[model samples]
Target: MANKSVFATMAGKLLPRTDTRNHEGAQAYSLSPRQALAQLAATGTFNATFYAGAREQLTEVLELAWQVEPEFLAKTAVFAFERGYMKDMPALLLAVLSCLHGDEFGRAFPRIVRNGRMLRNFVQVMRSGATGRKSLGTRPKRFVQAWLEQASDVEIMRAAVGNEPSLADVIKMVHPKPTSAARAALYGYLIGKPHDVLALPELVKAFEAFKRDPSLPVPAVPFQMLTALPLTREHWVAIAETAGWQMLRQNLNSFARNGVFEVEGFAERLARRLRNPDEIRRARVFPYQLMVAFTTADAAVPKVVKEALQDAMDVALANVPAIDGRIVVCPDVSGSMSSPVTGHRQSATSKVRCIDVAALVAAAFLRANRTARVLPFEQAVVEIDLNPRDAVMTNAARLAAIGGGGTNCSAPLERLAQEQAKVDLVVFVSDNQSWVDATAHAHQGTATMQAWNKVKLSNPQAKLVCIDIQPTTTTQAKGQADILNVGGFSDQVFEVIATMARAETGADHWVEQIEAITV
Candidate 1:
């Protein structure tokens, strides 16, 4: 009976010793080059996080991209853009490929740089000289030219929204040979050069006519193009009626401010549009995005519209699997989790933080599986009763309110061990900067690993999923058959969690998922 804890053997493979320090200076395991690249591709926005700066993130991603094979880099770019729905990191990877691997860059270009914003991001990042070369390089220039040439006139007009490297700037740099008189005219118009106005596309003509005479019917152009123009509430009402799902969700406040909501029957129409399952599915709305809309809506925004956002949350959470057996979700509500989820960027910082995302994940699970247990952890487990029937936004708000403490990733698992609880799956949504439970010695894996070992003693089949909401190359728990380390705030993570919880993925699950991408 002497020191059973010291002498006991675990049923699982021995955890790897902590090999590196995380951004929080806690002992952690360094991810492999491929794993690190994929993790960063999924979560890194190259903005300042609580622990790392934008430059540091950019350096790390470039370093990791260099370490991995060109194929893996291509696959990761495809995975990040298509599955993770990430913007900047995927473009960065593709930019890196442009210099070193032309063929892989070509394969990934059309996929990652799929839209206008992404196209601008590619040009901007490539020109930043952060990816080792400043110029677009010959092949990448050809790809850009082809993209400009193939996109429809409306697509090009929509692409004209953002700047830094505007679509016009790209057209100037690439000088894509116009295929038709209309194409040449459109290019000249975007770049502010004189061209035959008669050759312009009909939509462009309509937009120009509407701009000149406000009495005409409002053209269906991007809202940015119309914002500066003097328009009546009637025009805004028309824009609100026709705005796409994402556009509408993002502009509720603008609609309210413009008195578009004052029109009779329009509010009800909008509420229905927001709650439509088909619209939500087609838009690929993330649950947190709905949370943003719900929280950011002004008082003038109609009540029905807010309620419809909640309904949209339920639809977005459709992928959150109702896994069988006991489950525990641990969301780190530490002080650092308060950093902007997308990292901090001046004038562009997200009101949503890492804690909010963790809470959203936990609440979504409880919504999907009524029996699921949620333990919000800071230095230790914060006890709170949550009604599964409550709206996902409500539960998420409650969890996020309990915040500003040290992170101890092991606390919930240790509590589960203390209670001798039998769990089928344990999900940890956090920044993974667990230092409160750090051990003094380097030989030990981590406090989280040690606690997970104890938990596994009673339930060997139990799975663990660590969803890192911030970008980092290390984890408190090393990934194995029973453990998965995935990153990103996109709802796609829920699908990965569901698949992993069912034991459907092999070792290096995250990397394997990236490899499966057909780039």
Candidate 2:
């Protein structure tokens, strides 16, 4: 009865949404309360409570998920209750606790473990009495993990991030001068995720703590910016730079047939014995250069409205200190990354739209160097040294390499890691699935594959950033998403890059103040 009331309370808070009317007794049903409420909702008893006896039984809501392995799912609960479920509860716990096999869940859990009291109890229980214990944390209940696992990545991220800690909240919690556990819990919470909403107040406290005392491992540079691709609209949807797709001054067939998209050797000829001015003029006429030039003009916008972007560019530039603080992005030529990344996917339209994001990030990097490289990567990395003097041959190699295959993150990560001079950061754009092994089959449900799989870190010290493009939720209307074969690319890339980026930009570093600039 009490649990039912609790559920009712939660429901009331959750209900009365902007849209649809609230479900009368729905929220209360979540609780495994006493028999009365169910009986009432059902057959209208307890007051003849029969939520189960109702026209539509109270248990109907659980039917869909339980339908997974109908006989097993349906019968198992009863068997567990009547027979020996709690005896095997740990195993069942693992079964239900899906995060052990989840991607972002596993990644965030250990950190959450340190913060949550219930999780701490669960972990302790697992250590003493469980057969299976996962590395991220403990498996106390199958349902707990499974329920958490069923939730998506962003959902988990939001949940893991608690209410943004504010100064007032801390003041309100009157500690009996504070216990050690409470203090550590509070301190860890503050440092766990700086700049995050729930954790921001804690972060601010930590910063004040650090400023007062200089030696407390002044937090590392947070490299989150480089890890996120700037070229794509999704990365920083506010950046108004028009990335791909020319407005059709000329027809595609006509342009391709004539010398439009052609890669001429004007730069080569200019370097050779040729009278290069005209050759440079011809190079200037090439599409890529025209596009790059277009992108830069947009990058120079003033801060106010585009403050975050300008700050990103400023931080990226300041950290790397580019020759002119600009990057020339010749993204992967493993395939037709030569096409504008934000355009249509009709082979011609969507050719390299994905690469556009990479280019933008790289451009930000180059703006630091005053110039950057836009190369192709497939079996190997080919420097796409585009000539500012001559533009025609620029897209030549990229055009030829348009049909790229086999992308190796190891190759790039290795190269970036090996570089003698430390650049501020690195960002790569590709459909990440390319890095996955075809043999990497899913051994269990989506859950199992995520938990146990771990790729060896190639660039141990370097921040290896990757933005794998997946078919957008609206892909059917937009067209086939990029066909890159890297399975678990997004998960893998985000995991590695976020950690590294966080390290690069110290926790003390202000996000907006870090030396990055974005237009």
Instruction: Please write out the lDDT profile of model 2 over residues 455-500, one tens digit for every residue.
Output: 1122223322334342111000000111111111111222333344
Expressed as tens digits, the lDDT of each residue in 73-107 for candidate 1 is 99998988887788888889889888884489888
Supply candidate 2's per-residue lDDT for 179.
Answer: 29
lDDT of 2 at 16: 15
Deviation in Å, model 1, residue 35 alpha carbon: 1.0
| Residue 54 lDDT in candidate 2 | 23
Off by over 4 Å in 1: 1-13
Write down the worst ten-residue block by lDDT for model 2. 473-482
TM-score of each: 0.96, 0.26
